[model samples]
Target: MDVSGTRATDENTRPPAVIKATARQLLVKVGAGGLSPEAVAGDSGLAVAEVEAVFPHRDDLLTALVIDAYNESAAAMERADEAARAAGASAGGRLLAVTRALRKWSFDNSGEFTLIYGSPVPGYHAPQETVPPASRTPAVLAGIVRSALENGELTPPRRAVPGPPLLRPEAVELFGGLPPAPFSDVIERGIVLWSSLIGLLVFQVFSRTHDSVRDESAYFDFAVAVAAEGIGLVVPLDDGAHTT
Candidate 1:
């Protein structure tokens, strides 16, 4: 999975495995700002021209790092979701698990997280190549919502209590160019829940709490519960039984 989803195997498109592996190691140490083809080559004991052939510019190297970060984080979320499913967790539980996985990923790879989600580097406009890789995590969240919808556990928004309004373009793109069925009307709420999940991580990762929040874990659980409900996920009962 070279992020392009093409026929380019590890033997062809990118540099050698050691080069990329060593580059990531250096990325962790130096952060995105300090990253350079020459620097990576110097540390990896490989020729700079060899690295340049694979990554001609600084932005190319940055793009690779960004793709790697997104893939890793998305994999964490998907793996956690699978684990939750294996343990007989409901859709809501799976949502919580994936949310927890994302937060944990941010903490574990703080530098990488900041590299993509933090302040944009000047003049570094991500090319179209970044879109699919960037969509991976959101696709996982959408899957949780879709599962709940398919199981009839998600409640549709009522006319009177309409959950915000999504503009035409975004709604259409929310689900593979087709607005979410069954829960189509609540796409705006879904958008809020999705963005808010990331916002919560930004706050926690940047220590925006100023040390006031005694238990971030509890707070995260609370937020996940809210997001679950926001997307209309039915909660299981006290006896660990689903009422859906």
Candidate 2:
């Protein structure tokens, strides 16, 4: 009995788990760029044909890993937000909690975080299947912002000199007027707030800030505060006084 043939048969028959396991190991061992059917097969002990049978190409593997990372990140955000609510935090605090949660996940899972948030995987364009999972984390923040706006917790930013428009006319329809046409500026700031979280992580998690940020944790909290305020999560005057 040839063990290699038997193992190959198992890989061929159960390609889904084997391929997923292979992709996960490849992400940890070689990062996204190193993800290929050959590498997956080599590490997974599957035939190259077996790996390709499931993934088809490197992009397929990348999409699987990307979606996994996105889902995990979203779950982390949701869990952190839940903790914030448990502590009787305001909507703004919940937003900050999710941001901090995701940032912490980025530090812990740097490779996967980079796979999702870092850079594009060169020629690989993620298909539409990735959209919903990819949108979950942003939806978390968007929900908070929409709540703040509806509940009158948000302070609409006053742009000076009436600068050029940021979002297209179509974006209004897409947002379903949550910010409303009158407060489109508010939605714009909401987007920047979302990006700021990612930017902060890229800076800290990727070592771009290195010596520039001596206390990254404090800086992150401070930045989260700024971003929270940017989206109109106000710290009550009494609460502020009590903390310091």
> lDDT of each model, Cα atoms only?
0.72, 0.72
Deviation (Å) of 223 in candidate 2: 1.0
TM-scores for all predictions: 0.79, 0.81
lDDT of 1 at 146: 69
On residues 1-244, what C-alpha lDDT tens digit does candidate 2 reach at each position? 1011111235375776677766766677877888888888888788999877777878877777778788888999999888877998777777767777888788877888888887787888888888888878877887777777777877765552167657766444444563554465776776788788889889988788768867777677777778777655774322331110
Tell me the lDDT of model 2 at 176: 53
Cand. 1 Cα-lDDT: 0.72
TM-score result, candidate 2: 0.81
